[model samples]
Target: MTSPIQQPSRRAVLRMVAGAPLLLGASAALAVATSAPALAAQAGWRWCERCSGLWYSLNGTRGTCPAGNVFDGGHHSNGSGNYILKTVEDGGRGQGNWRWCGACQGLWYGGNPTLGYCPNRGATGHTPIGPYPTISSYYLIEDVGNRDSPGGQEQWRWCYKCAGMFFDGNTPGGSGRCPKDGYTHSVTGGSYVLRQVP
Candidate 1:
């Protein structure tokens, strides 16, 4: 037979009253944790293992790589780390005038009068869609200092050799290909950090 239920002692009742705040605090903390927004990231940008340049990989065609002949004369993305580029829509913290080359599918700096080199489009420079000043659709990339934020992949630098952005992370394979110099890309200027898609 079950024992008769006994009323809680005064000490037990007092202890529960004291612990109520702790329970409420835990519940509030949990609600905040669940309500926080998840980190957002942009995708479709990738490192070309063959050309050492950053290229947009969302197209039906893989686009040309200076290294050449890897996959149907296109950029090789094998072993590439997926990168998320910050666009102008995100904020104005980064630089703009970065445009995608339709001819080669690589990112080129269009701020200068010179459009930069394009392997697929010959030495005449990359053939980007849209007119001068403001390209129809331009991409803005963030330039970061030595200290990178959480999930920010550093070691990306500008290649004076190709006038393109390439990954120079401590890759054992060495800096990827550079079409202009017909060799690995040479990093110059400050290091850039690209946000890695989590």
Candidate 2:
């Protein structure tokens, strides 16, 4: 008679089979991590956006964005239809929050036309040119020659609710009601003095 044959335990066999997939997954993850540097090297440029500012780096050499945000793999839109993968030099003017004045075809600063005047029009006042967050704060001041003032520049108003700058043009003349917030004080009388940017 043959000696009793040895057999593997059922539990042991199951454990081995289950562990195979886990081992394979771990190996695959390791491979991807190891290849990441190579992929980054192949990348031509990278960009990062932060509350403080936008930044860029070449060939993956740049560090993380401010506040420890990771740099994205590609370029980002400047909200002006242009894809930017690098920081733009704006002389010493710094980045400006500007709005387009359609009537004058120029730009005004700080969203309030009354606070400042158009580039070419002196302090004639501003009209609601378009939506906020224009493409670029920088605009070419067009010489539209001399034309009648649009006559509806929003008066500088302060909203107690939003604590943001409100324009009188949004409401009827002499009314202090904010569009987003109910009645507030008009900071510029019914009108405001225009200060042009140099």
Candidate 3:
């Protein structure tokens, strides 16, 4: 005698159908959570007016600023609003020096005070005491691909007297005269020499 074929009970089939939507929703949520961090790694920088701070965004989506205002993509400066927007190239590929400014409490480009003051503060003095414990720190960004030799890239430093950034490699031992302040500061060593690695 042949065995009779069996089917799923009607209740079992109905239970599975009822759970389908919940299963799909869970899967979607998992997908988003898993991908968020990866997206954030690739996101560039953004500036927020409300918080007067810089932020990062992934695929143009960012959380509300601390002050609850939206972020601005391009550079912007609003004196009345007391906010400014700027972007720093990812340190992945660049040749320059970064320094810590005690006055502005932020990192600045070049070794001198002349490359303009920090984002928050006005201009300050650039002394040649090899980075000062009171104000400046050593933050250098050297281009591995291009050394400061022959036809390679030149070393840069900030000049406080001139209030501008200057190439120090042109002079011997990275000691160059400031256009406005004359010969004073050395662009080689400073207080904290903090090196940033990519």
* Candidate 1 TM-score, true structure as reference: 0.69
The lowest-lDDT stretch of 10 consecutive residues in candidate 3 is: 80-89
Candidate 2 lDDT over 1-198, as tens digits, reads 010112222333444656765555667545544431112111122112221112222222332221232334222313211111111112121223443343323223444435343222334543333343333232111112211122212233333232223334332333332222233432532332111211
Top model number, TM-score? 1
The superposed Cα distance between candidate 2 and the true structure at residue 63, in angstroms, equals: 42
RMSD of 1: 16.2
Which structure among the candidates has the greatest lDDT? 1
lDDT of 1 by residue, 1-198 (tens): 011112333334445656665555667555533431112224677888777788877666678888887546888788887666554333334566666777787877777777677888667887656223333233334455422244466777777756788888755756878888778888777777676556
Q: In order, what is each prediction's RMSD in angstroms? A: 16.2, 26.5, 20.7
Candidates' lDDT values, in order? Answer: 0.63, 0.28, 0.31
Model 1: lDDT equals 0.63
How many collisions between residues are there in candidate 1? 0
- What lDDT, from 0 to 1, does candidate 3 have? 0.31
- Look at candidate 1 and give me any clashing residue pairs: none
For model 3, how does the per-residue alpha-carbon lDDT over 1-198 read when each residue is reduced to its tens digit?
Answer: 010112232333445656766554666545544431112122132333333322222222342221232344222223212111111222222333443333322234554335543222323432322223332222233444432222222244444443333334322434433323334434433221112112
- Candidate 3 differs from the real structure by a C-alpha RMSD in angstroms, to one decimal, of 20.7
